[model samples]
Target: MPDVTTSVRRRAFLLWAVAALAYAVDLGTKLAVVAKLEGRTTVSVLGDWLVLRVQRNPGAAFGMGAATTIVFTLVATAVVVVVIRYSRRLASAPWAVAFGLLLGGALGNLTDRVFRAPGDFQGAVVDFIAVRDFSVMNLADWAITGGCALALLLSFRSSPMTGTAGASDAGAPGAREA
Candidate 1:
């Protein structure tokens, strides 16, 4: 069996560190954009395929949840706390990374919502990396999406059938599918 105590620490630290790194990058880029562009400049790349267009988001993925920053922030904070508290339950690196990416993205956006806006607790998230006809996103957002995708891939790597003594335990009353 894996060392549950050590695994717990590994998961928590890794997740928080990943999140912190992501938040730093996200905040730094947004600061640069705000200082240099102030939402007035656009740098085109790939012939209109991509552009650095500054935008503020107060919502969820793809610009959803604009009306609920307070609620969302609280939920995000709760998620971080829960994940950190339950890190021991994490069984793999992919899960650890996924949790970290999500935590970092949430905290990154939450920082904006808490301190960069028209009012307290109503700040807007900085989103760049505009895609024509699609929505604009930032690094934090990408990290969360990418991390979740990677986690999903990892989950597939060890389905229940491939689990420890899976076949031997398959006949058990509590056996589960992968």
Candidate 2:
């Protein structure tokens, strides 16, 4: 018997640690951008498709929402909570990694909201990754989007989160074939 009370909280800790790291990296880079670029500079990564264009965002994803950084901050907090809650239900390492990335992104943006510029809790997020004529974004945003995509793809596997029938539940008349 592997008699141990170590618990499986390592997964949860990993999720949070990844979040912290993402947040730190984002914040540090944004600070550096503000110091060096001073909110007006561009470094082309792939011609015009991907560029490191520094900018500040005071809204939700893709610069859709606006001005209400406080509201966005609240939403970020709620998202972090939900991510943590759902992460505990993950049974696959891939799923965990995906969720961790999403959580990390959220935390990163949230940190900016809570710490940088304007007011105490009324600060905007720093976005630097630019794509042609589209809105500027940062690494955290990419991680969040990518992780969510991965999680959705993994949902069709063996998770109870997906209502679709898997291998064991295949061809049960009422269920569709796997």
Candidate 3:
């Protein structure tokens, strides 16, 4: 069996690699959308079910909090810092991947918030990929959402109090043995 340190290191490497890939894809898609659809109208990709519509959003996901660009920027910065700080302790592959996705998504949006348009540290994020009856989002948004979902699933599957692989009923206050 591999040692704990080796396992952790391997997970950390996976986290960084995945983060880099996610960030790259997010940025690339945003740039391509902006360049191609700057002045064009929405182009339906799936017969109105999905469309390509370029938009600059100075807000949170789904275009909420339009007036809180700076605040979100600060929050993203904090998230990146916290993720990096905690990544050193990540021993699980799934958790590492989750954190990586989150970090990449945050950084992808943070780049636009810092360098896009309007002004520095207050720029709008380039958002495209509109879903009918849903919201217009980008790759970063998907990554973040996916990461959150995975994290939630992992949390629900593990022991809550002991951080173990399975739930324990042995030490319950009032429990019956099977």
Candidate 4:
């Protein structure tokens, strides 16, 4: 078996690699959507089930808190900081991937908030990809949502961030069966 440091190094690499890829994809898609769909009529992609349109949402999911763009920017910055700090002890592949997606998504939106429109840290996020009667969002939104879902699943399964069941299973009655 590899040493602990080696394992951690590998996991950290995986986390950052995934983060870079997710960030790139989110940024690329947003640029494309803005260039092609901005100011244009909504185009149906799946016959009303899915449509493409450009919208600048200065708010949270579903465009909530439209007046809190600066707050959101600060929150996103905090999230990025927490994720970086947590990565030091990353030992689970799933957790790494989840955090990676979260980091990428946060950075993507934060970029827009810092340098997109009406001023610094008060700009709107570019949202495209309307889903029928649902909300209009972008790739970053999907990444964040997916990461949260996976993290929830891992928690439900009692998966530890350390990638070991050692302490978590200790309290169970039959955990020490000989």
Candidate 5:
């Protein structure tokens, strides 16, 4: 078996690598969209199913909480801090990947909130990816959404209610065995 320290280091590396990749893609796409799509009409990529349109969102996902840009920035900062703190105890590879995606997504938007137009910590996030019948969003938004879904799946898989292996039910008040 791999030593605990080695395992942790490996997990940490995976987390950072995934986070970096996600962040890079998010930032790169935002830059490209801004450079190529700003001040222009939407460009269809999939027969109106998907299109590129430039927008600056000063709120959370789906254009909600537009007036709370500062609050969102602070929350994103807290998430990054929490992820870093929890990373030290990450023994599960899936959890590491989930947290990495969350971190990257959070940082990608946080970067805009801190450095983009309007002002510091109150700047708007650039969003472009638009679906015909859904909300317009960006790579970071997709990363965050995907990360949350993965994390929820992992949580369910590790829950005792799911009868996952190694999930102990011995401490339950009305425990029974098959």
Candidate 6:
């Protein structure tokens, strides 16, 4: 059997590694979009089905709650705190990745909120990717959306966040023998 300490460390490492990678990618892409496309006309990548148009959003996805940028910032900060505080107990690789994505995405948007424009903690997030009849978004948005979906799936599967086994092996071959 693997040592508990070693297992915990491995999970923690995975979580941090994923978080760092997501954060880096989100930051890099956002910066590139801002520098290259902020003032230019929309660049079509695949007709009108997909395009890149720089937009600074002070609201949540789909540009909702434009008047509550500070609230979003606070909520994102809370997510970061909760994820970091609960990471020590992670045992499942999927859960770790989910939380890591959540953390990294939160931090990515949070950085924009803190430093972008319109003052600290009320700054707009840079969004560039747009789909037909859909709101503009970014990599951070994708990460957060994916993380939430994965977490919900794991929860439905009754996967344990801190255990040697996940759900059960009841349906496995020879899981039960006479």
Q: Tens digit of lDDT per residue, candidate 5, span 8-81?
A: 78878888888999999999999999998999999989989999999999999789999999999999999999
Residues 1-178, model 1: lDDT tens digits: 6555665566667777887888798789888988887648788877798999888888876788899877767876787687666555554556777777877777777778788876578877888889988889888788778777876776676422122321245565546554
Q: Model 2: which residue pairs collide?
A: none
lDDT of 4 by residue, 116-156 (tens): 99877999999998998799998888888988898899878
lDDT of 3 by residue, 21-118 (tens): 98999999998989889779999899999999998999987789999899999999998998898776664778888989999999999999999888
Task: Name the lDDT of candidate 2.
Answer: 0.71
Taken over the whole model, the C-alpha lDDT of each candidate is 0.73, 0.71, 0.84, 0.85, 0.86, 0.88
How do all the candidates rank in terms of TM-score, highest first? 4, 6, 5, 3, 1, 2
Which regions of candidate 2 are displaced past 4 Å? 1-7, 161-178
Clashes of 3: 0
| Cα misplacement distance, residue 67 of candidate 2 (Å) | 3.1
The per-residue C-alpha lDDT of model 2 at residue 139 equals 77
**Over the stretch 1-178, how does candidate 2's per-residue lDDT look in tens digits?**
3212222354456666666777677667877877887556578799989888777788876776777778988987898898877655444456666778888888888888887777677678888878887768887887788878887787666354322222244544444444
Q: What shift in Å separates residue 46 of candidate 6 from its native position after superposition?
A: 1.8
What's the CA RMSD for each of the models? 4.0, 4.9, 4.2, 3.2, 3.9, 4.7
Please give the distance, in angstroms, between residue 14's alpha carbon in candidate 4 and its true position after superposition: 1.2
Measured with C-alpha atoms, the lDDT of residue 73 in candidate 1 is 73
**Model 4 alpha-carbon drift over 4 Å, by segment:** 163-178
Error of 1 at 109 (Å): 0.5
| Candidate 6: worst-modelled 10 consecutive residues by lDDT | 169-178
Clashing residue pairs in candidate 6 (N, C-alpha, C atoms within 3 angstroms) = none
Tell me the spans in candidate 3 whose CA falls farther than 4 Å from its real position: 159-178
lDDT of 6 by residue, 1-178 (tens): 7777777778888889989999999999999989889999999999999999999999999999989999999999999999998787775889899999999999999999999999779999999999999879999999999999999998887666654433344655434332
> Rank order by lDDT, top first?
6, 5, 4, 3, 1, 2
C-alpha TM-scores of all predictions? 0.78, 0.76, 0.88, 0.90, 0.88, 0.90
